[model samples]
Target: MSFQLFGLPVARGVAIGRALLVSSSRVDVAHYYIEPAQIEAEIQRLRMARDAVVEELETLQRELPGDAPAELSALLDVHVMLLQDELLGAATKQWIAERHYNAEWALSAQLEVLARQFDEMEDEYLRERKADLEQVVERLLLVLSEGGGGRGRAGGLPQLSAATGDNPLILVANDISPADMLGFRRSVFTGFVTDVGGPTSHTAIVARSLNIPAVVGAREASRLIRQDDWIVIDGDAGLVIVDPSPIVLEEYRFRQRSGELERERLGRLRHTPAVTLDGEPVELLANIELQSDAEAAIAAGAQGVGLFRTEFLFMNRNGELPGEEEQFEAYRGAVMAMQGLPVTIRTVDVGADKPLDRLSIHELRQEQGLNPALGLRAIRWSLSEPSMFRQQLRAILRASAHGPVRLLIPMLAHESEIRLTLEMIDRAKQQLREAGLAYGEVQVGAMIEVPAAALMVEAFLDRFDFLAIGTNDLVQYTLAIDRADEAVAHLYDPWHPAVLHLLHHIIRAARKRGKSVCVCGEIAGDIDFTEVLLAMGLRSFSMHPSQIPALKQKVLRTDTRRCSVLRPARGVPD
Candidate 1:
């Protein structure tokens, strides 16, 4: 039987492939048969998974702070012992070899066997150890799932399957972090479905940048989809079709080809400048994370790099923050890669939804029953940790010498925060000079994310060299919607009359001040907003590289002269 699941259609394309499932927890894993010839390979996977878990446990133990609870340390040690026990690895390997089960299934089967034996044990303490054993197995299961098909440089999981055939793989996961989704650029996966994520999520934003078909917020996608199941992704319709009949498959294949042709057609606009039909030039920029993302930006013919999120450097590092030199090199690489194009490096925005690996989700929002969105994040987190903030600032300042670099601060709403931030930048420059380090000047800008900042746009334009409108957070804050929260994601409207009014106010304010302004949010990349924003006097857009072509196409068709009748921001709702 054929069934379909609905989600937010983020990227527009069609993908027909086999489902490859990844899980955040061990509760659901892909179970498939292994070929007789591949039994040894499966055992090797089990060994690698075990070793990875062991390494992770050892790292945790070594990094445990001296102030950590005695019981917590002891519990970690117990889990390490369970993971290192020879019997666990030996028995799990046996399951793979004898039963031809895949790595995750084999290891889980062994855990079940041990669990049953413990349930029948006479000693209560030994029986209770079953929970510890289960924890160890769960950890190993997560490693095996992330290990994917093969490993690449920097220990990246390159592909989802070793199978080299006609049908490509489609990743189905409970949820994927933005850092993990960056790996998709090199992976063989044709498309992906996440059980939880809103349309404007950072992960979804990264998915769009990857230029792959994606369906997010599919409530039961991970639970319902099984390994190696034939799947059809109608990204335009936000539909995931499973077990499609031959007739339906044929129809989808045709649609897939049509989408491909359309993409190919858009590729022709890569080198063309974005100009309205009336000859108003529009600048399109790219929002990149890693240094390697520069190639995609240049290939996409972006005028420059805007909104270089520096926070991604601090994620998934096991609590170890990148030092000033490391940060400088990373920043420099991006500037150099742009080859004279300007790169705007936003200061690290960690906390809230993008907490450091050391801080759990609960820890981020436990105090005052506070919502992370409203908690200390972005500039607040940076301001709270002045030393770290200075380190990042010094690095960005040094990178300025290599190429044109712009400093962007996120989520600022107070005069005191702005004053402190400016003083810190001066202090960082002084420290770098005292250290005899080469540095250069950079234009400092502020991200207008909060409604408070947008309301006081004149104050921001007065102090800042430029302004970048982060429409994602602007709408969320304006509507009191947590953009990342799926429960109210639909309420997070970028087209709210108030949101449009704010955008109009900010853009109008910037123009009046003769200061440059750019929209570096998800809505900036949306082709639907190209003409509307152009009418609002927005001449610059920063977004995922994949979004540029279609937007440029829209820009080429828009007539700014004719938009005078549609100029009023309040006229949007009417």
Candidate 2:
């Protein structure tokens, strides 16, 4: 019987493959008591498994492709940390010795207790981290059961046979760990469907980097499909079809070919300028989170980096923030790599969704009610902590000496906030001058994400050198939707009338004031909306590196003068 399942689409593409189902309940360990005389051997067994898992993870990290997303390496680093955790190591051994329980049983018990603790946390981000704890425990349990042979058939991943047909395999799992995905590098899986993970998860990021078709958060996918069942994954539409009929399979096959052709056409435009038929040149930039992404941006032919999110430096650091030197080196490396292309670095935009656990400011978040999105974040949080803010500003200033750099302030809702941030930038420059340090001219910009800022755009035009519209957050705040919340994700529409109105107003306002504005959000990367945005007077677009080619293809083919005459009521293609 053919059946369909839907999930969050984290990566784009389509695949037809045989199902490779990995059981989620593989980690269910049996409780058994061992004699006190056998405790030493059991403890040694547990130690050896932990050591094996660590070695495997380190090896995976070492073998990761140079072109892989930087976050993939960071994910492996987190796994290595979990294996080296004292609680997972020493405490599990203590439990084994005291309770005379099997190593797997003891580890399972510890994981349950820790997971319960994490479940009770007030912060949503930290609560979501419980999955990481579970993933590591699952890996340890697998190693212990498989006798540390390094995760092959015994680990539940299918072994491709030489006699098998050429059909690709679609991996279905309750959840896939970054380590598990890394282990499959030598395999020939075409795509993956998981019952867990959001768009921003490490799994999703890695999948995108690999250009794999993936549908994540597909509840019950592992249970619904059996191994060897034919499946179709429409990653662009977030659809997973199990035991697909011949007609449906043929339909998807056509769509897959069309998608491939489209990609090939876009690939041909790699060096093409993003200009409209009327000779209006649009600047295409890339939005990157890590310093390593500079290479990708250049490869994608980005004029420069429009949005260089600096938050990744603060994350996965074991509660330790990156110091000034570390921040300086990262910024300088990115600046130098761009080779005169402007890199707009936005300072720490952490809070609410992204919390800095080590900072004292985040501790007060528990009292901020259920809505942390509206609470202190971005520029507000930076202003509250001057020392941390100054360190980042100084690093950015020092890096500016290397090449063209721009400082961007996020979540600016008030004029007072912009004034204060500018003053701080001046303060940072003064400190550099006092220290006899040389720095280049750094342009300052602000993100027009807050509805308040969008409406009061005139006040900001004179204060900031350039403006960038972050449609992702603007839509969320305007529609009162939590974009990350799957339950409310449908309501988070970029095409909402109110959202379009606000976008039009901001872009028009920036143009009227003779200030350059750019769109640096998901909408900017969406090829379907490229013409609409261009018609709406958006001349600069910034998006993910992978999306630049397709968007540029659209830009080159668009005649903005004709598009400006077309209205939504005229049945324009979306």
TM-score of each: 0.81, 0.70
The total number of steric clashes, by the backbone 3 Å criterion, in model 1 comes to: 0
Tens digits of per-residue lDDT, candidate 1, 421-516, equal 999999999999999998887999999999999999999988999999999888888998876667777887787888898998899889989999
Give the candidate number with the greatest lDDT. Answer: 1
lDDT to native, each model: 0.83, 0.80
Worst 10 residues of 1 by lDDT: 150-159
lDDT of 2: 0.80
RMSD of each: 7.8, 13.5
lDDT (C-alpha) at residue 38 in model 2? 77
Error of 1 at 143 (Å): 12
Tens-digit lDDT track for model 2 on 436-524?
Answer: 98889988999999899999999889899999998878988998886555566556677877888888888888998889999987788
Residue pairs in candidate 1 whose N, alpha carbon or C atoms collide under 3 angstroms: none
